[model samples]
Target chain A: MRTFSKHTPLEYAVLYGRFLSLYMRSKMQYKMDTLLTSAAVLIRECVTVVTLYLMLQKFSVINGWDLGQLLFMYSFVFLSYSLCILVFAGVRDFQGIVHQGEFDSYLTKPLNPLFQVISRRSDLMAMLGHGGLGLILFLYAFREAGVEATGMNVLKVVLVLIGGILIQGALLLVPASLTFWLTKSSQVQEVMFYQMRGFIAYPISIYPKIIQWLLTYLLPFAFVNYYPAHYFVGVGSGGDGLAYLTPVVGLVLFGLALLLWRTGINRYKSTGN
Target chain B: MPSICSSLTKFMGYVLSVNIGNMLFNVWTKVAPVLIVSFLAFHLVLPDQAYMIVLFLISLLLGYFVLYGFNLIVWLSAFWFHQTWSFMTIKNAVILLVSGATIPLWFMPAPLEKVFSYLPFKDVYFTPLSIFLGQVPADDIMLTYLTQIGGIAALHISLGSCGARRRRSLSFKEVSESANVQQTYPA
Candidate 1:
């Protein structure tokens, strides 16, 4: 059965694929600079990881969490966040698109703007995020636990990873779509990004009660690593699968976010010349 | 001196106007996390002794103000990437040292915690939360705040001098680029 989309979903997919391929070609056009900057960005991410490890070394535990458990948690969160950034790099740039009147370009193209947005960044970052940190964590966890995590544990970890990515992408949509209302190309985007990072980097247990509630119910950053972490470590089973459902929560939130985005777009449409 | 301070206030207003609303949002994102983490640790980790929570919050804020003040000074100085990283690194270290973000100052040797008490590092992560945790008395709050402000003011002077010196060298475009880079990748 044909969908009600103005541009057939398949047609939009093809167009998006073409756009992404072209975008990559353009990036590759500046091959050396791109390589250098890509490396810089990677190193920056590595520094963040190093901070966590150092914290572990300093006290050997945060709150009550030990090194091994925290490391397991780190692997989950870093791997998940990396995947989200890698796959949804375009989401991060939503502000620029709104500011430059490029959303209009997307609208006129007769595609679901989000699909086009998501698909147009072929996502070298995602591949790196999934495998790069994933391997390191996997090896460490394996060596330390000596087969306690197991194949089934690893598979569940992957599921939790997927959940984390979906929730993260959904979270981006809400703040990103706010550019429609804010109208200024301010540091709000970076601010929110940093806020999320600050909130996510440490154990969720470290936040104030108010913030903990918000992160769990509102932003859902806790689920990215914490829930799945408790599970694989055999400590997560106590009703915390609630954390893994963050992606589902995110999906519903995304639907709501898309509504806001459309409303923002409409506001822009009326305001524009 | 008060007249000079008034002039400085006017100058800062002018600077804020030129920079736009970024400073407000930017400041919130930078400092709010420190507040949140400090407060949370006070409430949760050691809840039985409610008095201790008060002590912890005060201790944490003291540590935070010192580091944040120091950080602003470093940021305003010559644009060295290493210094920028140091600002963040040192700020994190301060938190780790005090308020038990990593290691509790209490767990350390008495002499160490006592030395840290005067050094301003404990002011960042430990003091605010410790005060909130009620580990420290209400009377100590003023002393903590005074010391933190003193540290911050001193560093601000040092940073402002460095910025004043560089004012002649940096062009408008370079200023704009620096601001843009800051907005793009705060991490």
Candidate 2:
């Protein structure tokens, strides 16, 4: 097997693709299962969007943001979240690895531990479910909001989305890596990935000042969708410059998470030993 | 390929195969967390009307059974389709929407509200919530109770019959796969 550490960026990408495809082929052995799972994803996403639409119909707006703008924000949040799940789902199951002492196996290999853990599993059904649907909704909402479809603006949206995914992936990794010390960090993972993550589905402004502050500074989830979305819609108090910080914040958070992960690695005590 | 009805049937079949204690334990395992959280949260808020609180408790009790009955069916679908994770996600999303966990039914658009009224999902969360918020008037209380019962009855009977059919038709491979149930409710 080729060693992972010396690979260039292009080579790394090819290796990751190979790992993902191998997993995909294994999953696709159950064709009906894959199709049903994809359908379930599609249905779930549609229902969530519909719930938002119905709520929008009642009040016509939430916290001064219109439906079209809300949809744009919503779609972006979904897109980034789904991408995180697609790319870094193995982190979601990191607890199992630690419990089973599989972490040692990754370390034994010549590959980068993080890459091996990340590319170990890929839920492509979720990618097709949320990514495809989210893109369509984002475009439709973009048109409804009357935003000009210039190339630069589109690039900005795409980049911000990538940033958002990174932020979410960091959130997953940070709590998950804690399993090295905590042994069972599923509760922490649930709070970060599920409960806290839900707050991003709506405008952060509707929440009280304390929650807004927590999301902004403590958790930094505001940079995920709220700040960038506010920038796109040209609403909210701070200057448009804050919007540019999203991708930067994403990169910083991910770097911090990696640092935490390294610290956890140093502290790791294999379950068997 | 697993229609809701067929899945429900299969789940009911599994339910019949399991012992009564085990079945209740299974439901409790799924429900205890929510109950504990709600119990703690209930102390945080003091309702103005005692009668409304009483009505809320009653409606909530009924809602628990109704919700769990539906949830049980959904959980049992895993026996047939190991890919029920996505299906469970979809079911919860739909329940959140139609059951008024996301937004109260009153705040919902008229057409959506009308549609939800016909579906049994409202009894799962919405009806009880409306009672707690004191949104449900006294006259409408009976109607809601009747609806909740109707929903529960429909699910209970369907599960029973479907489970009976599934227990008879299950192959040896399926029996081995569902070892958890077989250990409890022996053939």
In terms of lDDT, the best-performing candidate is: 2
Q: What are the per-model DockQ values?
A: 0.06, 0.39
Which candidate achieves the best DockQ against the true structure? 2
Candidate 2 residue pairs in backbone clash: B12-B163, B13-B163
* Per-residue C-alpha lDDT of model 1 across residues A1-273, encoded as one tens digit per residue: 124466766787687678878888876774544444444444545555655665565688676666666667777666776777666777767766666676677767555677767776645633463447655875686455333656876676667778877777777776677777786534665555556656766667766778778777777777777766665564422345575575576577667877887776666642252
Candidate 2: stretches off by over 4 Å = A1-4, A8-11, B1-47, B169-187
The reply for model 1, stretches above 4 Å from the true place, is A1-10, A122-131, A142-151, A185-193, A236-240, A243-247, A270-273, B1-176, B185-187
Using TM-score as the measure, the top candidate is 2
Report backbone clashes per prediction: 45, 2
TM-score of each: 0.61, 0.84
Over A1-273, each residue of candidate 2 has an lDDT whose tens digit, in order, gives 344468788988998999899988998898876876767777877877887888788789888888898888888877887788898878877887777787789888887888889987877777788887888889898877767789989898888888898888888899888998898887788777677877888888888888888887767788888888888887555546878988888899999999999898888888883
lDDT values for all models:
0.61, 0.77
Alpha-carbon shift of residue A173 in model 2 (angstroms): 1.4
